[model samples]
Structures are given as C-alpha cells and as structure tokens.
Target: MKTRIATAVLAAALLTACARDPQPASLPPAPSATSTATSTAVAEPCASVITRMSERERLAQLLVVGVDPADPDAAVRLVREQQVGGVFIGGNATALLRNNALDAVQHAARWGVSIAVDEEGGRVQRIDELDGTLPSARTMARTKTVDQVRAAGRERGAQLRARGVTVDFAPSLDVSSQPDDGPIGDRSFSSDPAVVRAYGLAFAAGLRDAGITPVFKHFPGHGHAEGDSHAGQVTTPALASLRTVDLVPYQDVAGFDGGAVMVGHLTVPGLTDGVPASLSPAAYRLLREDYHFTGPVLTDDLGAMKAITGTYRLPDAVLHALLAGADQALWSSGGNVSAVLDRLQQAVDSGELPATRVTDALGRILPAKHACG
Candidate 1:
C-alpha cells in the first residue's frame, strides 16, 4: 500500500509540473498599455455565497414565478417558502413604484434569486411606466431598420436594469407567418424571416449593451400555430419549414453571451408529436444541436399550457421538463410552489435529474444575477 501511495504521489507531482500556470509569471510584451491591462485583468468570479448555496437554495435558482406586488407579505412568503430561483413581475407588480419593486426584487436577489420581467412591447408590456412609453414591436418592425429596434430595446433594458430586473423576456423572435396568430400578431416583427433575424440580433445586442440579459422567446416559432396556447392545444406545421422561418432569428442570436431562450408551450406535430415545446425533447434537442444554443432554456409557463398540464401533473411537469433539457421552469400561479419544489427535489433524488445538471444550471443562473445585480 505504501509503495502504491508513493508511486501515486510521484505521478501526481509529474502531472502538476506539466500543467500550465493559471496566472502568468510575466506579462506579455504588448502593443499598448490599454491592451496589456485588458489582457491581464480576469473576470471576477461569482460570489462565494452563491457558489455555496444549499441544495434547496440551488434549486431556488431554477424558478422564475409570478408574485403579487400589492401583497408584500404574501410575496415575501412566496420567496421564503417556495425557494424560487427568481420572481417574474407582471403588470400587477409593475404598477407599484419602480423603487419599491426594485427593493422587493433586490431582497430576493440578496437570497441568491434572480428577478425578471416580461416587458415585451405591444400587448405584452409589463414595465412601460418605468421604461418610458413602449412602442409596439410592429411599429419598430415597420421602420424596417435594425437601429429602430435596437434603440427601443436598449432603452427598455436600461430602465428595467435600473429597477433591478435582470432578465427581460423580449424580442419575440417568432416570425408571424400566420398573420392571424391572435397573441403574436403584431408582436412579431414581420412575416419575413430575414427581417426578423436582423431586428432580433440588433435588439438582443442592445439589451446586452444596457447591462440586462435578453431571452429569445416562443422558440420553434409560435407564428405558425393556429390557436392560442393559453387554453387548448396549438399545433404548428413541419419542423423543417418552421426552423427556416420562425426559428431563424433564434438561431441568429444563439451565440450572444448572456442571451438565453424561453421555450413556448405550443406543440409542433413535426417536432415532438403533440408535446409542447417546453417539455419536448425534440425541441430541446433542436435548440441544443441545430441552433447550437449554449445558454439557459426556460419554460414560458408550466401552468399555462394544457398540452403540458393535461399530460403531466405539476411535479411531473417539473421532472419531465428537466429531463427534456430545460434549465428552468416558470410557474405563473403561487399555489403551485410546493408542488414545483417537491417535484424538483424528487427528480434530484431519483437520479432522473442529476444534481450535476441542477448545479450547472445554478452556475448559469448566477451570471444573470450578477449581470442584473
């Protein structure tokens, strides 16, 4: 045993000698002082508390649920009890003073949770009062200039960031191919995929510039769906055609750092039989492999889609979502809090959802927090 241990120690010493030093012993001869400074400075590591949160705390980082701003006590209870990874403020919460909302959200952030908002213009505006009046996405699209969209996005981002909103679920990338899509009609840029791609990229860049992370939403195209996803089933056409059109913008912006995606609840028969995109292995696979999307993936709302809720119970939805490759699950109703947590914990215990995956998501969750904080 001693001989073996001695051999192992000597081998470890040899490997250590071969490893490259993390901090350079000497600085590179540089073209300029600025270049040298830029090259030598490393990014600040994540906060130690965030890195070392308990299993429950880490799990909390995977949620972005709704809360009522009027009920401050209830809101605090939700945060303390639900172990939410984050809270997504809706119009109900947005109606409060921006500073008050910031105070509430930052309080959640202090416990290592993210604070997010919709803030998509047109019918989807949440923080319009804080961000100046928001223009409909259709109006921006009508300008036919990336600059128009970028400017609006930047301003919206700045305002939200000022209020401690870390994630802005904006720049609806779905191409409104079916002009009759009720919820997504003018909210979409245009029927033309190329135009949407250009505008979406510009908008995403603008949000990044304003120090807020943007989430590309309704992936695999909500444009082709015939019915609304809020109630019943909404199916789309072929995945091939949808990808080339509705998904083009998403593909274009997938490489942007700090840019994540929100998978809608709509089902595409061509992609995953009848499963909603949020729980579709097919959709997640496409996002991961085809689009090469390396950032986090979140559900639009687990409680909103019948395709999801009908097929799986709250806990089942949570388990299947993680299994299907979603990094986080959004629940709109506060009643589902315990169910969501129990489901996630059950998944972790069963080995169906590995702790490593949950931890990996926890790490990604932090960057968004730091970006917003």
Candidate 2:
C-alpha cells in the first residue's frame, strides 16, 4: 500500500503545469458544435439574477473555495455567511464527505454550492477508502482498449456520482514520457499524442456519461515539462514544440460534453513571457481564441501551488486569473474565505476587476453550476 501510494505521489507530482502567454493572435476554425453552447450564450433570467446579487455574492460566485472536509459545518458556514459558489474537498479529508455530508451546505445557499473532488484514480483520489480502488491513468491506457477504458471510466464515475460529487478532476490531457516518478509520469495516459487523445477522451466521456462533470486539465500541456508546480514554477517546451505534440488532444476538446478545463502554470517561451499561464492574459487568449474552448475555465490550485504562490498572494493571484480571462480561480487549501472575497470586492469597486468582467464571468459560471436561482 505504501509503495503504491508513494509511487503515485511521485508519479502524480504535477500533471498540471501549462499556462503561458501566447505566440499568435490568430483565431482557430469555428468552435466545435458543443463549444457554441458555452456560457457566453447565457441570456435572460441569469443576467437578471446576477444583477440582483450583492457585490460580495457576485465575487463569491466566481470562487470555488476549498474547505475543511472534516467539519461539515465549515462548508455550511462558508455558503451561509460568505455565500461562496462552490466548496472543494481536497486531500483525504473524508469525514465531511460521508452520508450526504454536503446536503446541509447546499441547503444553506441561495444559489447552490458545487461539491468537487480529485477522484483522478491511481494517485490523486479523495474517495479511495470509500469507493474501491482503481488503476492509474497510465495502467488503464496501456491495458484497456478505448471502449474498455470508457467502460472503466463509467464504472468509476458512477461510484463518484453516488457519493454526491458533481465534479471529477480526471483524464489528464498532458502528453509525456517523463519517468514514472516525474511530475506527470503515470498520471498521463501516454507519451504518444494519438494514444493520449483516443483514450483520454474515452475516459472523460465515461465520466460524463455517468452524469459527472469531468475536468480536462493541465493545459496548454504539462507532460514533458520541467519539475512540479507544487514546489516551484515549471517550464514547458517552446510553443513550436507543443504545436505538434501537447496541443493535439485539445483540438477536438469539444467532444468533452459537460466538461471543464484546468490551465497549468507553465512558462512558455513565445507565450507567457516567463509568468505562469494562470495569470497571463496571453495564455488565456491561446485557450479561448486559439483552442476555441468556451467552457468554464479554472486555474490550478492557487492557494497552495508554489508556481502561483511564490509570486502573487492568493487574492492577487486569483484577481490576475480573473482579469486574464479565466472564469474561476480555485484554491484548495481552504482558508481565509472572507479575506479573498473582501479583496475581490475591493477590486471590483476600484476598477481593477471591473464589474463587467465579474458579470461576464458569471455568464459562464452560473450556468455551469446551475446556480442562477
């Protein structure tokens, strides 16, 4: 048990490290069919709903705050007092996840709170103790055919769905052949771009088929990158290197029905200009304009990740992501909910994070969470 976990810890070191500035401003072909349905098409009642919300609530809605998983009441307090839009159960904090643990949190909210977890099988699962263990992404990819992989994903997604979880952060899209102990390692499906694409989409489809919102992560790509973002900033090959390899899987990303995206904090040469992608507008442009991904976009864990923390404070880090075009900023360490929200509120008033951006973000967020009540 120790060996498997330790191996996975090293293996899953950091499969999420791809966000750089941008190389070009060119727009890709028309977004895929599903891409057209992104929150940008939001209309009517939801817009009115946003107007009715308080500045604090509006800002809170864009946040997916991490919370203490041992104390169910802590989640309730966040929703009732701070009115946060979502609560994340990070690490192995399972005490609050049992027996409808999140029901109370939802009941306390006017909109609703999204309960999320890293049930990425292999190394990064939060429900292993409760749900039976599953193999890692690499193992499944090597042994299972695409159909079999989809079925496996469905089985696992069903287990997660039964536990009242709405989001599953899985099906890492990074392309890599780094050592099994490297940052991405076995967490990635394969080093070959085609194998990664077929099996990756199949697994994600399985999760979505089971009614779970799978989050395709670590864009523009983290595989083959240097180091782990958890320890410090990471760098990826130049944009030219990624054009043929890492970015291929994302070209057909419109296939991930009812899914979301998690950008990395990678420094790309022609793109991010040395800063992490999470805070770089150029990076967001690459995703939104180049990749044509209009779904709800989230930053990697800002509250805890060193790639982001070593520079900006939590509040500033989140603000930069929002200003840069990310719809939501996630911090899974779960502290200072009030302080973050206060900072966001101040930004809106001071014109740092304009009210229009807040509303534009909500157009994407409220629909994704079904929180427009």
Positional deviation of residue 124's Cα in model 1 after best superposition, in angstroms: 1.2
Q: Write the per-residue lDDT of candidate 2 for residues 1-373, one digit (tens) a residue.
A: 0012232232233222212212224322211122211236558879888878888888988888877666788778878998887777765657776898777888888887777877767777777888778787888899899999999889988887777777877779989897766788888899999999898899999988998888888888999688788888899999988989999999888655588888888888888878887777777778888888877888888866678777666776777788777788887666666777877888777776777777777887788778765
Compare the candidates by lDDT and give the number of the best one. Answer: 2
Sum up the clashes in candidate 2: 5
TM-score, per-candidate, Cα-based: 0.81, 0.88
Model 1: per-residue Cα lDDT over 1-373, one tens digit each? 0001122332333244213113334322211111110011112464465455676667767877766544555666777666677776554334433545556545644555666767767667666555556766666888747986788788888877777677778778878844432668777777888887888778878888898878888888887777777566778777877866777787666568888888888778777766777776778778877887777788887754555555556556665666666778886544566656776777677665676666556556666666324
**Candidate 1 similarity to native, TM-score:** 0.81
Clashing pairs in 2: 18-264, 19-277, 21-271, 21-272, 22-271
What clash pairs does model 1 have? Answer: 60-85, 61-85
